[model samples]
Target: MLARLATLCPAPILQRVDRLIEPLRATCSTKVKAGSVKQEFEKQDELKRSAMRAVAALLPIPEVGKSPIMANFTSQIRSNPELAGLFKRIKKDSASAPSTDSVELS
Candidate 1:
């Protein structure tokens, strides 16, 4: 829904929505930070991987035709060394893992 809205909504309204959701978005980042700390304490690779997925899902997709603001935000995430590394690992792991959604034909 958000992605659809972000894609179709006018720029002025999207800007307003972005402003309204800024605090909530920050909270998601805080949760990711907390998850990182927990992962470090518990030595949990799964936690870190899941947190990376969450961060990627919550952020706007960096595709063409998307809002400039969202594109810039995604660029910032990719530019951060820590986040870029995590995202890289996420991509690698996903590529190696077999698809869970495959269905066998009767």
Candidate 2:
């Protein structure tokens, strides 16, 4: 009778379930609050922009069309409305520069 009862009720599977529940009990007891994840992201981005300031002004931004270049570009465009000079500068720097493709794409 004992041999028949042991076969009907498995001990090993029940012991394995207890092992799974032990770790889960810790997770169930503690409650974590979600806070401003965006603030964390903006803080990181601010760090990145400020980090670039460490380099000297002579660094030329490596490419064009970015803020460093656009600030230069807008000033030039504003001075001369012809746009020929701007187009030439765009072609020269587009490879490393940010998207100067808006003109060509259209």
Q: After superposition, how far is residue 29 of candidate 2 from its true place, in Å?
A: 35
- What is the RMSD of candidate 1? 9.8
Off by over 4 Å in 1: 1-51, 54-65, 97-106
Candidate 1, residues 1-106, lDDT tens digits: the string is: 3334444553544445445334433532443446466655454444445655543333432332244544554465567675567667665565554332121111
TM-score of 2: 0.21
Q: All models: lDDT?
A: 0.45, 0.34
Model 2 C-alpha lDDT per residue in residues 1-106, reported as the tens digit of each score: 2223223543542334334333323332233345747776566444433322211111222222233333443344345443434334434544563332332201
Model 1, residue 13: what's the lDDT? 47
